[model samples]
Target: MDRKQIINDPQTGNKGEAFEAYDDIPANPNLQRTIGDVIAARYGRRELLKGILGVSATTALFGATALSAPRPSAAAVSPEQGRYNFAELQWGNDETHHVADGYDADILLRWGDPITADAPEFDVMNQSAEAQLKQFGYNNDYVGFVPLNEEGSRGLLCVNHEYTNEEVMFPGLGRQDRADFAGMTRELVDTEMAAHGGSVVEIARGNDGKWQVVRDGKMNRRISPLHTEMTIDGPAAGHPRMQTSADPTGTRVIGTLNNCAGGMTPWGTWLMAEENFHGYFWTDKLDEDGKPDLSEQPEAEQMKRYGAPGRWYAWGKYHDRFNIDKEPNELNRFGWVVEVDPRNPDATPVKHTALGRFRHEGAETTVSSSGRLVVYMGDDARFDYQYKYVSDGVVSEDPAANARLLSEGTLYVARFDEDGSLTWLPLVHGEGPLTAENGFASQADVLIDTRLAADALGATPMDRPEDAQPRGDGTAYVMLTNNTRREADQVDAANPRAESSFGHIIEIKEAGGDHAATHGHWSILVKCGDPALAEVGAEWNPETSENGWFGSPDNCAFDAEGRLWVSTDQGSGWGKTGKSDGLYGVETEGELRGHSKLFFRCPVGGELCGPYFTPDNETLFLAVQHPGTDGTKALKGFERASTFEDPATRWPDFDPKMPPRPSVVVVTRQGGGKIAV
Candidate 1:
């Protein structure tokens, strides 16, 4: 998620220079922001005929070759390049493996064990601050599981620790800024708010059957964003720009940020997604008025387009309302969609606020047999806007009233319709051009300036949705992640490339298959560049763009006999030069054709997150964040800055000199067949 550069330089514009040392990343190197040609020259082109009435009502019933399928069977990537040739193998320092020889039994859950009965154990040298907020925390991103019925038999799991690791979960090695604000005397802000939000735990399966992590179960918990409560749902719940005084009806808000890639809700409940909740607030500029101004406010360009800066992580002096002009509703209580119920562990982790707050990166769902739910979200940054919320409370398949219909919903906003289709649009509360004459004066200002009211209700500015998944035949699959600010005359027809830099996945469909359809029928269905170019067939003229395609395409899923794992995110022009990050599994059905290789790399200071699968498709979890964090200055035991080390990936099969732990691995399938294919 680093291509942000909006820096007018307030100390490298908040948390930039990746917390110091040999900095050099935020090179805004300006001249990029054309806000897409002043948003398509002030929105002037219209007719997408609801994308030709949703591709003439589903291309005469699925004629569209089930939207291009039949591309697999190329030996689905030689057993992951003959078991891990993408490097980053160290297993001793707790855990790390970009997959070693096609799986079948692998485990690592470290960083304190317990899981609840009031968790708290792993020490890493003295660690505390209320026992790292009831333990089992520290690096572990997006893991999902629910099962418990329909023959799936029993589950709960949930994970998501997307941040934190001051020299391996604290107790010093090199430390940064060193404030120690006493959020209970900083065990580094209690291991950065107990490893940034997420953990439901409760699992169970073992006795050599796999699954594990139920330590003391009873629906284990831990929702921290510094103590979790989170309520606020839909059209900015009680908006006065999300009022407060501890929620005097700004609709409750307190916890969750950077909780990355999530989903799961058909009445069981989970849905987390608060990606980069704007680098945890810190904008002070003396606002309670002793006098200071700092240009831009009337919601500073809509809270800096959802990376809110009523202040953001001013880490140096430590805490004191991490200064958002002294709490402008604490960065409007973090980019929404929180949910969580994992079978009620005292259930109170909300913030659905009709899913508008941006920078989210996850939310998928699908319901309706006349209960109308359909969620699907993603706003991972660069070029943003791809949402869906649809729920004015209709859920009645009764899982206790469909977990209170995700606190009532309606939010929409998506528009791409030239030939391909899609049209949701409704950010409700007085719909259609929402009010105060379009500048939206209500519905909590169209869900907190939802990308400037999806740009006065036109929506469709993609190339950065980052994970939606769905296709068991209802179609969804989004991802997008690359848009080097699309130049070459701003390109359009729903982001037709300009300065693409590799990224595109789309798919859509909706309408009668109804994910509570407002409209749908998109295509492109896959167009990630780099196949040893040749103008990549006139910029993906009409589909086919596969062969080990590279560059930015971040978080994706679809494993249970569906195949399509693609992960990769880091920018710069795609191989018209350098830059490379890995992970890919493309086989979108049959004969295993569309084979794209490069299965796992990350390690040079990683990035390949949330790749779940286990629903009997046999295990395979994976999260491995920031290994030897390549910013240096945090080294120890064998010059730490880890790679896990020794006889390659043995990873916490019981320690080998700790310090490389960002744990969470379970892969499976050895002789079980059908995995890593």
Candidate 2:
């Protein structure tokens, strides 16, 4: 796999798809007795039965019950079998979204839709940063709700605008990254910048049980990289490395970008995680090979470790800070979880550096049995480590004191052992490998170069960890999306597969029923892929229907009933499986423990994200991102890159003038009942 060649070619894959595929290629070459090596030794490998998988070794890891019986047909499971009681939604690629039989998937908000009261109507032909700041941003990923009332009838929806599809965003600016951003102007780049953060809008339930955007909602606001000012907090707050030309003080910075999967604090604060922040940076200085020229950078080693100055977008062409050659430290400002008070529009969002900077996929927070705030996070990169932050202080009735919790915490990276035990290695400044001897001078340095410090400590590198959801019973589910780059010798007990393309889920049971516990027991919940293909080594419950089995499990949510629902982001790789990215109900316990059922699916070329269920569980908000853009070339009829002019499907609004817009969909059971009941 020649990544450099693939990246240099403009006609290969679309801009975002090509970059993501390249990024998935493992960057870390420092594996010694890492997770995969430990797993193969711990599990005792057997001879490969077929070219695709090791049957005996796989069964040993996922339990003999996984393959006790042949997989049932797609419609074999009955509704009364497990906790999830919805009829499975048939899986396939299509122009429109679909849900289970008794539910209604309503479009609540679309990109460029007016979010504030005085915002102008969406006009695709005439877009400006000014208008975008007042409207909904593009490619919504994370959807979190902060209730305004006790019944949760009214709440603020905090939706993250992950990124923009330049090919489908502008009318004539067909892919710009590969062309050296020749078609992008200052205004167009500004608009893209304005659409990169998160949107906070108040929504209410009407008499008909449908969720509607409250246009006049007092707290409606947009946070964007264009102009929104933010402050740095925690140990790395005012570090010298964070000081940039624009903000010499180092305490202040511009808005956040690439805000992906996030979580809501118990006190009503929204935590937006900056994932893949490296891709937005740009640099004109290229070597003879046409790769980013980082030879002049002072922090070249650190920059390469974190994948900075990727030049995926043209933002740095217009903004000096995004260019590594001009302002190298600016890349360090992002990749931390930014906490925002959605209730107060005047509140300045703070980037908590104590969380330890990396490609933070999700900041799912929960209160430990001891009352301390425990946040489960994934690095969201192949061969990266999973991390958790335990606050020093416990929660109280006062929201102000709880806000201080994030600023002062001990961050730890996971190290899964062959003994089926998980150890949380503290990343404190003076601890273990995170000391002055290993380039970490202060706590700030450890937090800033978190990946480097974790590398020194020999943290277990799992397969693209993303969106870990911790349960109330002190159990945490860590999602290993996929890592086809992993070899047979690298397989570990935590991730028991080599060249695992379909990915798997690992359930962590915190010791002593305390999430803040430094140790726990870990096991593979399920190995994701097609159970029908024995070589693929899928390990779903035999009852998992053909439509139920899924791949590339990215984001997951535990509903009010404690049932696990997963959403996938297969990206351009969705072509591997004929099924479109969708949401599925997965059983975590009982006789039907590993059973899964399809609940909802996204439109063609779209990825399912933010499957957030309301407090009452009556409604589920699903964000369909990058619709009609990814993998369109794989679709039989549409064998080309999708643009605004030639989209695979103009979903939500089939209007001839409107392109397929990423939207937030509200799902409710017909006749007003709990979803999937």
Candidate 3:
């Protein structure tokens, strides 16, 4: 299920759903058999001559029956705790990009911090695109800086603003319509569009060794959907599937959406993910001339599947263009990893169509030990696929070569065997399992519409997969955000838990932990749950083994010591025990499979996101989002803007009455000691 499907309170998780599903296949042979029988047995009267056909493809990807016993280790633990203080706000709001040995470089920009003179200076009360484009912009998410000097002196900061808090960014939501009937009025739509993407700013260190945003810096630019242009690459480029009135040739599309936590290529580029693009499309039918659109279309179902756009947001007016029912191919342009070369702002951002897209959380890239470029990406929706694209064209560390390599590649969707081994199956045309009738017209179609292509190819359905990060060696870690709709019958060897409450972290090794192996090994390294809180979701029912809960795992990062720092999205209502959201640094090594120590806790209403480690591993930066998100009360009832008290979750010092403030936090030791060993 995608993010739109809400799980209400106190419902018996995944119980109301049917035992058999059109999309999912149960792992139990008996259940599969029963499902087949039930379909035939119940539909006997449908037709005298027709017979029911069972699932045509149910190959067992999981081999060896079960995963080996859990092997906990301390070597895998995160160094976040030992190195940095939990509650310190390092250098923040300086209007300048500066870095020092000790922490002080937290909250770098404000909502209206000017990027150029044309962009106005900070004034929260009144804001505009003219000012925004020129200013530091709002709500910075993922921050990646590439050091210009070997001594780590200067670099570039690439940050994404997931979305805007319109109320806070605009004056009284100004005449905007949030109605879903007609997707959105142009005015209202423009406002939302402006807030969707990221920014690439040039930063340099002064004689004092401090980094500052150099206005008019040669490479400084803002890449937003409202104005940024992108080029199509790999499989789906120029395909009929992506054709729209906007770009009838199907070769270009405007802007990327909800660009979140991403990775920097070893070859010197940034891989920004399109997280919630589905939210923008409206599904109602209407022609370009505003006439009644035809109902019969080749991609009607596909349009329905991707949120049936035109659904309104928090505001109340409507424009109908987002309706994909009228324009089925429009929605196809999103969900792919868009690559940006910060060095060349004018270079069209390349949508690496080879990597399948589905609520793309982020991507991690590494030149495998064999020296091939392997891009690992996840479809954030529950039950989506984990994909890796290996360029048919070999890799080179040369910046120019790497930029051209991702444009052409062999994409593979992963399948986990029961024996703990995983295989990256071919997702190209004329290859194994991908044929014309199976909905894959060609390799390009399979790559562009990867979710459907993976389903056709029998790719393993995973819990919400977000941010796949590769460790120093070849092992990769993924944050499997919890899935509350899974049932006992759905639990397979790899997934292990049904209706898991606390999401888990998955560890994947390419064969011998080689970054470039076509085949690999996989296992759940850690399951989130409070050891003392007792079991939260539905019990294992005696027959099913108890898979304890940790909370939901979001983005993750590795320090110089090879430890895993996990951020959380546990503040959502789906969490068990209603625990306060926080960040955890796990130290995994011998005998420490899931030892998660609380590293830093966001304010009560905040969620910790974007855990990025500087290249030197000297600093850990995190984004604290929506410190007072529960600000639904009337303005009269609204206390001062920083109302994060009443429910204390003080990270560093643990105070109760402190006002909630969302900012980036940099952690370092007081006396220069390694953090979190």
**Which candidate number maximizes TM-score?**
2
Q: What TM-score fits each model? A: 0.32, 0.97, 0.76
- List, residue by residue over 1-677, the lDDT tens digit for candidate 3: 22223211112111111100111221111122211122123223122012111122001111121132232233332234233224222211111222223434445444445555355555544445555566654455666776666866566777776655432334334212221223334564565566557777666545643346666667777777777888877767888887887788888877777787788887678888887675556544545533224467676545444433423342212433355555557678887888888888678888878777567777878777777778878877656667887776667656667776787677787776655577887777867557787777787767766666666667777777877888657888878776655665544323345566566676788876677677887655555654333333111101111211237788887777677777777533322434345556554443334445455555444556777766666556667654444221211333222222332223222334232234555555444344543
> On residues 183-224, what C-alpha lDDT tens digit does candidate 1 reach at each position?
223445545776678887766656565667767778777787
Better of 1 and 2 by TM-score: 2
lDDT, candidates in the order shown: 0.58, 0.87, 0.56
Task: State candidate 1's TM-score.
Answer: 0.32
Off by over 4 Å in 2: 1-4, 8-11, 47-68, 488-494
Q: Candidate 2 at residue 316, lDDT?
A: 86
What TM-score does structure 3 among the candidates reach? 0.76
Which residue pairs show collisions in model 2? 36-490, 36-491, 36-492, 39-492, 39-493, 74-546
